[model samples]
Structures are given as structure tokens and as C-alpha cells.
Target chain A: MPSISLTLNGRSVSGEVETKTLLVDYIRENQKLTGTHVGCDTSQCGSCVVHVDGKSVKSCTMLAVQVDGSEVTTIEGLATGEELHPMQEAFRQNHGLQCGFCTPGMVMSAVDLVAGNPDISETEIREGLEGNICRCTGYHNIVKSVQAGAKAMGG
Target chain B: MQNFDYHKPNSVDEAVANMQASDDGKFLAGGMTMLPTMKQGLAAPEDLIDLHGIDGIAGVAEGADAIEIGAMTSHSVVASSALIQSDLPALAALAESIGDRQVRARGTLGGSISNNDPAADYPAALVALGATVKTNTREIPAEDFFVEMFETALAEDEIVTSVSFPLVEKAAYAKFPNPASRYAMVGVFVAKNADGVRVAVTGAGPSVFRASAMESALDGDFSSSALDGVAVSADDLNSDIHASPEYRAHLVGVMAKRAVDACG
Candidate 1:
């Protein structure tokens, strides 16, 4: 087993994990951060997305050991005590999610997208969300939510 | 995925040593393809050598007449790089069209060519651009690097260091991607250089191959009209549920023309 240490959500965390332990599994099973859903074990579904060193990546496709010494931010870390992150607040205000299965990943991916290009266009947003699959087919609202979130984040 | 010992080597030599010492070992780049294959039980290596820890192998540089991109450089980096965008926008556009944003954030140029997925887009660009694939041992021309589907000329202990793409007068790539996977159903890359025109097609065949007939036609006129009645033979094209061989053959002509037009 490899002893891995990483800054999770803002705190230093360490664990002894098998080489095959996926980052998603390490977060969900070991660290009890269940907010990051596992909609598709494969990389197709971006439901397992998390921020690794400020970049969005599919946690399920990466090994826990691979992220050792990196900064990981899950959905649970998005909120500030009582206040929701602007993206989460926008999702709440715009009704971006249905059944809430893909919301976390969608929100995380959208945040990164808007952060990279604050002036993103509608077509760019649609293309940017290609990696995430919303089973409920509620992309229209999701796009609106991201637009609102982007504006709220001063994009 | 099966349990395998992981080794993170700081240098190329150390990574190769780790691979040579293990009975069965695999070098992991971005894990975009290798990890999924392992998860599906399609591949199981006894030892996994992670190449991410190695420094000085993951950036882009520019020379007088060409661009040198490190093997570990991610697609996103290449796609967004100002240097590549200014000097080689066609390659940058091709990189941006790969997979999606998240995959582009992780998938590396080296890994994509090394895997040589029949439907991958990079092989077409490499072949058409006349790129040189640099390795730990020697430099392999793009034409020789790709042997067949999912196979390359890379030796067991060799590791790709970087790739050098020569600047051309004009170049463009166009692809009809499979809707679901974004892998090219039929992709074409056309380039016009000092020597002449080179056209490479992927996803329609078992491996990336040059379209000599279309190249010759374009070399004469360097316009899409030159390929007016030209056609690619369907004899060696791949036939799958997504497209029939004849359909892919048709796409080869269509995409080649599109690429040529986009080159302007």
C-alpha cells in the first residue's frame, strides 16, 4: 500500500490505499465525501468529477495515489458554512437539476468552464458540458444556471 | 481494475528500468485509455509505471520552422497554447475537437498516438504534417511510428520524448465524429508544404493511411475542385455498426474536400 497525503477540500489528509483504489472510491468510501456521485464508473459520465489542483478531472478514472500531494476539492467543499457557492446558489435559483443525480459534477464542471472563459457563449457552454450526461435531459435549465452563475461570479 | 504495483519514476531512464524489471508492465500517461481498458478487464499489467512524476517532459517549445511539443503535453494545453494557435491553428483546432473539455484536460498527445486507436484523430494529423516522433532511443517518422490499429513501432523499453511538427504553408483537419464517443468516424488531415500536398485519413481504415490519389490531385491544383470526382477505395476501409465500408469510403472523399477547403 502507498501512503498518500493530499489537501482535500482545504485540509491535509493522508491514508494508506491500495494502488488500485480509485480517487472516487477514496473520497466516497474512505473520506465520507458522498457528494461526488458515481453515475458512470467509466469516464463517460462526468458525475465523478472533482477539482484536482484547480482543474476538473474524472475522479473515477484516476487512482488515489496519482493525486498524492495534490489539492482536491469535492462538492462538499463548495459551500461556505451556511452560504452556497455562487454556482450552487444559481443552480438552486434556476432549478438546474432534476432528481439531482448529475448536479454536483455539472456544477463543478461548469465552474471550471466559466472560470477559464468568463465570457463563454451559449454554444461554448453546450460544447463545454459535453463530458457530463444529464439523464433527466434538463440541459436547458442547466445552461441557464451556468449563465447566471457565471454572471454572479463576476464573469 | 486488477491490483498492480505502481511505480512513479522521476526520470525516463528510471521509468524504463522499472518496466524492464517487471515481467509485465505498462507506462501510464493520462490514463484516458489505459485505465478504462484495465477497468473493462481488457488489459491487466503486472506493474504500472506512472510517467507523470517525471519532470521536463510536459511542455511545448517553438523552433525557427517547427513546433516541438513534449509527449506528455495535454491536449488542452496544445489547444489553448498561443504559440500553437498562432503558428499551427489547424493542429490546435484538431486538439480542441478531441473527446471533450475534461478529457482534453488530461489526455496527452503522446498517449493518443502511442495507443493508435483506429478512430483516433492525432495519427491523421501526425501523418499529414510529416511530424517526427522523438523517443528515448531514436526518432521515428510519423509514417513509420504507426504500424497498425492499436499498434506502433515503439519498443518495449522505449519511451516517447516529444514530437516535432514542421510548419507548413497551410493545413487543416476535418472529421465526422461518432456522436457518442467523439472518436472520428472518418477524419481527414490535409497539408500543403514546400514539398507538396499530403492527405492522411483515419477512422475509415484499420490504421491511418495517406490518400495518394487525393494528394496528387490536390498537389496539381491545391483546391477542393481538384478532388471533384476523386474517390477513395473501400477495399481496406473498416466496417462497423456506425458506418459501412462504402459509407466510410464516401466520407473519406467528403472529409478530404472539407479539410482542403478549411486549409484556406
Candidate 2:
């Protein structure tokens, strides 16, 4: 087992895991953060999306041991006490979700997108959310959510 | 995924040493391709050398007439880089169109080129832009770096340090990406430099290749109309469920024309 330590959400976390243990598995199983979803075995689904060093990355595509001394933010970390993140609030207000299985990842990815490119347009929001998929909403609401979220993020 | 001893080397020399020490070792980049392949049981290396620990290994540098991108640099970094967007917008566009945002955030240049997937977009841009792939030991021209599908000229223990891209007078890339995977069904990268016009085609062949006919025609006239009658042979092109060799061959010409038009 490889001993690894990284900042999760806003706090420091440490764990000993197998070398092949994916960051998603470590988050869900070891840390007991089950909000990050694993939608597909092939990693095509963005349901495992998380912020690694403040950049959006698929948690399933990374090994926990690889990020020994890095910062990671999962879906579980989005809310502060009673209030949800702006992106999360936008998704709820705009009905950006369908079954809610992909909501956690969608919100996480959306927040990162807004942070990186706050002036993102509808086309960019659609394109930016290419990694994330929402089969039910057809992405119309999702697009609005991202646009609104960008505004809420102050840009 | 199999149990492997993971080594995070602090430097390129240490990485090389760790690679040479292991019986079956593999260098891990962003794990975009490697992790999926590992999950599918396609590869089971006894050791995985994580290269992200090495300091000063991930960044882009601007020079007089060329841009050097470190191997660990991710697709998103290249796509969002101001230097690349200003000097080589075509390369930035190519990187932006790779995989998806999540994949872009994790996939690295060295990993993509080192694997040399036939459908990969970077190989085409590299070959067309006349870039040089620098390894720890030596530098290899992009023309000779790619050998075949999933193969490159990199030595067993040698690691790709960075890719130095020489700025071209005019360049553009256009690809017909698969709607599902975004892997290019056929991608063309057209670049006109001081040397001449180079037309590199990917996804259509076993590896990225130059279109001499299109290059010559474009050399005569740098316009989409210049490629009007140029015929790309289907003889050596790839045929799969996505498209036929004949279709890919035809798309090669079509994409080349679009690429040329995009340059303007």
C-alpha cells in the first residue's frame, strides 16, 4: 500500500491505499465521500469529475497515489453548511438535472468551467460540458444553468 | 488493474533509472489513456513510474521562432495557453478538440505522442508543423517519431522531455471527429512553412502521414480549390466500423481542403 496525503475540499486528508486505487474509489470508499458518482466503466461519463489542483479532472482517470501531495475537491465539498455552491444553486433553479445521478459531477464540472471561463456563452457551456452528459434534460436547462452560474460567479 | 509498485521519481534521471530497474515498467502521465487501458486488462506493467513528481516538468516556453511544451503539460493547458492561442492557434484548436474537457485536463502531450494512437490529433499537428520531439537522450523529428499504430521511435527507457514546435507562416487543422468518442474519423493538419507546404493526415491511415499530392497542389496554390482534383488513395488507409478506407481516403481530401480554408 502507498501512503498518500492530500487536501480534500478544504481540509487535509491522508490514507493508505493500493497503488491502483483510483481517486474516485478512495474518495467514496475510504473517505466515505459517496457524492462522486461512477457512471461508466469506460470513464466516458463525467460522473466522476472532481477538481484536482483547482482544475476539473475525472476522478476515475486518476490514481489516488499519483496525487500524494495535491489538493482535490469532490462533489461532497460543494456545500457550505446550509447553502449550496452557486453552480449547485443554479442547477437547482434551472432544473439542470434529470435523475440526479449525474448532478454531483455536473455541478462540480460546471463550477470549474465558470471559474476558468466566466464569460462562457451558451455554445461554450454546451461544448464545455461535453465531458458531462445529462440524458434526460437534453442539456437546455443545463446550458441555462451554466450561463446563470457564470453570472452568479461574478462574470 | 493489477498491483504494481508505483515510483514517483523526483527527476528525469531518477525516472529513467526506475524504468531501467523494473522488469516491466511503464511511465504514467495523466493516466487518461493508460488508466482506461489498465482497467480493460490491456496492459499490466509490474511497475508504474509516475512522472508528475519531477519539478519543472510541466509548462510551456515561448522562444524566438518556436514554442517548447513540456511533456507533462496537459491538453487543457495547451488549449488555454495564451502563447499558443496567439502564436499557434491551430495547435491550440487541435488540443481543444481532443477527447473532452475532463480528458483534456488530465491527458498529457508526451503520453499522447508516445502512444501514437493512429487516431490521435497531436501526431498530425506535430508532423504538419514540422515539430521536433525532444527526448531525454536525443531529439527526433516529428516526421520519423511516429512509426505505426501505438508505436513511436522513443527508446525503451528514454522519456520524451518536450516537443518544440516551430512557428509556421500559416497553419490550420480540421477533423471529422466521431460523434461519440470524439476520436477523429479523419483529421488533416495543413501547414505552410519556409521549407514548403506539409499536409499531415491522421485517423485515415495506420499512423499520421503526409499527403504529398495535396502538399504539392497547395504549394502551387494555397487554397481549398487547389485540392479540388487531388486524389487520396484508399490503398493504405484504415477501414473500421466508423468508416471505410475509401470514405476515409475521400475524407482526407475533404478535410485537407477545409484545413486549408481554415488557414485563411
Candidate 3:
């Protein structure tokens, strides 16, 4: 086992993991943050997307040992104890999710996209969200949600 | 995924040593391809030598007439570098079109070239630019590097260090991506080098290859219209679920023309 220390959401966390353990596995299993789903073991699916050092990455594709000192933000970290994140609120208001299987990753990816480039256009949003896959909602409401979320965040 | 002893080497020597330590060991670059393959049970190595920690393999070198890029340099880094954008905008654009942002962040040029995936975008750029792939042991010309699908001339223990591309007057890359996988269904790279012109085609073939006929036409007249009659032979191209060999052949001409137009 290799011991690693890194910032999780806004808090610094440390743990020991098997060298082969993926970042998604570590986050979902060891840390007990089950919000980030694992729809596909392959990297092709973006259902396991998360933020690594401010950039969105598919946690499933990366080994936890590879991100020894990087900052990670998952779906579980988005909301305050009582208040939903603006993106989350936008998703709720717009009915962005149906099955909700791919929502956590979509929300996380959308939040990162908005944070990275606040003044994002609809075309850019579609292109940016290309990494993420949503089997439900047909992406119309999700796009509206992200657009509204960006506006709500003063982006 | 098969269990393998993992070693993260901090330096190139350590990486080389780790690779030489076991016959069944494979150097892990971006893990974009390798990890997925391991997970699918397609490849199971006895040892995995992680190469991301080696600083010497992750930088860009600028020269008066060319650029030498470390193999481990991420696609995102290549896409955003001011030097690359100004000097080789086509290459930068090609880098940007690969996979998605997440894959670009972790995938490296060396990893992509070494893997020699037939549908990869970088090989078309490299072959079109006539780049030189430098490994830890020796340098191999791009023409001699790609042997076949998922195959290269690189020895088992030898690791790619960098690739050098001679600055060209104009160049561009164009590709039709498979909607499902986002891998190139067909990609064409057009370049105007000191040696007149070279056109490389990828995704449509068993391996990335130069389209001499297209290069000849463009060499005769460096314009999209010059390729009006040029035909890419369907003989050696790939016919997969995404595209028929005939369709890929047609795409070769269309993409090459698009690249030529963009080059201007």
C-alpha cells in the first residue's frame, strides 16, 4: 500500500491505497463518497468524471497513486450541508436528470466547465460536455441547466 | 485487470532500469490506452513501470528551425503552448481534436505514437511533418517507426524520449471522427516542407501512411483544387463498422483537400 495526501474538495485528506486502486475506487470506496458513479470500467464513459487540480478528469482512468498531491473534487463535495450548489439547483429547476445515473458526473463536469471558463457559449458548452455522456434527458434541459447555472454563478 | 508489480520511477534512468529489470514489464505513459486494455483483460503484464514522474520526458524544446517535443508532454500542453500555436498551429489543432479534454490532459504524444493506434491523429501529423522520433537508445525517422496496427519499431526496453519536427512553411490536419468512439474514422495531414509537399493519411489504413499520389498532386500545385482528380486506392485501407474502405478512401481525398485549403 502507498500512502498519499491530497486536498479533497476544500479539505485536505490522506489515505493508504493499493497502488493499482483507481482514483474513483478510492473516492467511492475508501472515502465513502458514493456520489461519483462508475457506469463503465473503461475510460470511454464520463460517468466517473471529477476535478483533479481544477481540471476535469475521468477518475476511473487514473490510478490513485498517480495523483499523490493533486486536489480532487467529487460530486459529493458540490453542495453545502443544507444549500444545493447553483449548478445542482439549476439541474433541479430545469429537470436536467431523469434516471439520475449520469447526473453526478454531468454536474461535476458542468461545474468544472463553468469554473474554467465562466463566459461560456451554448456551442462551447456542448463541446465542453463532449467528455460526459448522458443516456437520459436528451441533453436539452441539461444544456439549459448549465447555461442557467453559469448565469447564476455570475459566469 | 491483471495484478502486476507497479513501480513509479522518478527519473529516466530509473524508468529504463525498471523496464530492463523484467522481460514482461511495460512502461506506462499516460495510461489512456494501457489502463483500459488492462481493465478489459486484453493485456496483462507482469510489471508496470510508471513513467509520469520523470521530468526529463515532459517538456518542449525550441530551435531556430524546428521544435523538439518531449514524448511525455500532454496533448493539452501541446494544444495550449504559444510556441506550438505560432509555429505549428496545425499540429496544435490536431492535438486539440484528440479524444476529449480528459483524455487530452493525461494522454502524451509519445504514448499515442508508441501505441500506434491506426485511428490516432498525431501519427498523421508526425508522418506528414516528417518528424524524427527519438528514443532513449536512438532516433528513428517517422517513416520507419510505425510498422503496423499497435506496432512500432521501438524495442521492448527502449522508451521514447522526444520527437523533433522540422519547422515547415505551412501545415494542417483534418479528420472525420467516429461518432461513438471519437477516434478518427479518417484523418489527413497536409504539409509544405522544404522538400516541397507531403501528405499523410491515418485511420483509413492498417497503419498511418503517406499518400504519395495526393502529395504528388499537391506538390504539382499547392491548392485544394489540384486534388480534383487524385484518387486514394482502397486496397490497403481499413473497413470497419464505422466506415467502409471505399468511404475511407473518399474521405482521404476530402480531408486532404480540406487540410490543403486550411494550410493557406
| Evaluation by DockQ, superior candidate among 1 and 2 | 2
Candidate 3 lDDT by residue in tens digits, B174-264: 9999998899999999999778999999999989999998888888899999999899998888997878899999999999999999998
Q: What is the lDDT of candidate 3?
A: 0.89
Residue B15 miss distance in model 1 (angstroms): 0.6
**By lDDT, who's the top model here?**
1
The runs of at least 3 residues in candidate 3 whose Cα sits more than 4 Å from the true structure, single-residue gaps closed, are none
Chain B TM-score (model 3 vs. true structure): 0.98
In model 1, how well does chain A match by TM-score?
Answer: 0.97
| Cα lDDT, model 1, residue A130 | 91
Worst 10 residues of 2 chain A by lDDT: A110-119
Error of 3 at B10 (Å): 1.2
Ranked by lDDT from best down, the candidates are 1, 2, 3
**Candidate with the greatest DockQ versus the true structure:** 2
Each predicted complex: what DockQ? Answer: 0.82, 0.85, 0.66
List the candidate 2 regions with Cα displacement exceeding 4 Å.
Answer: none
Q: Which model, 1 or 3, shows the larger lDDT? A: 1
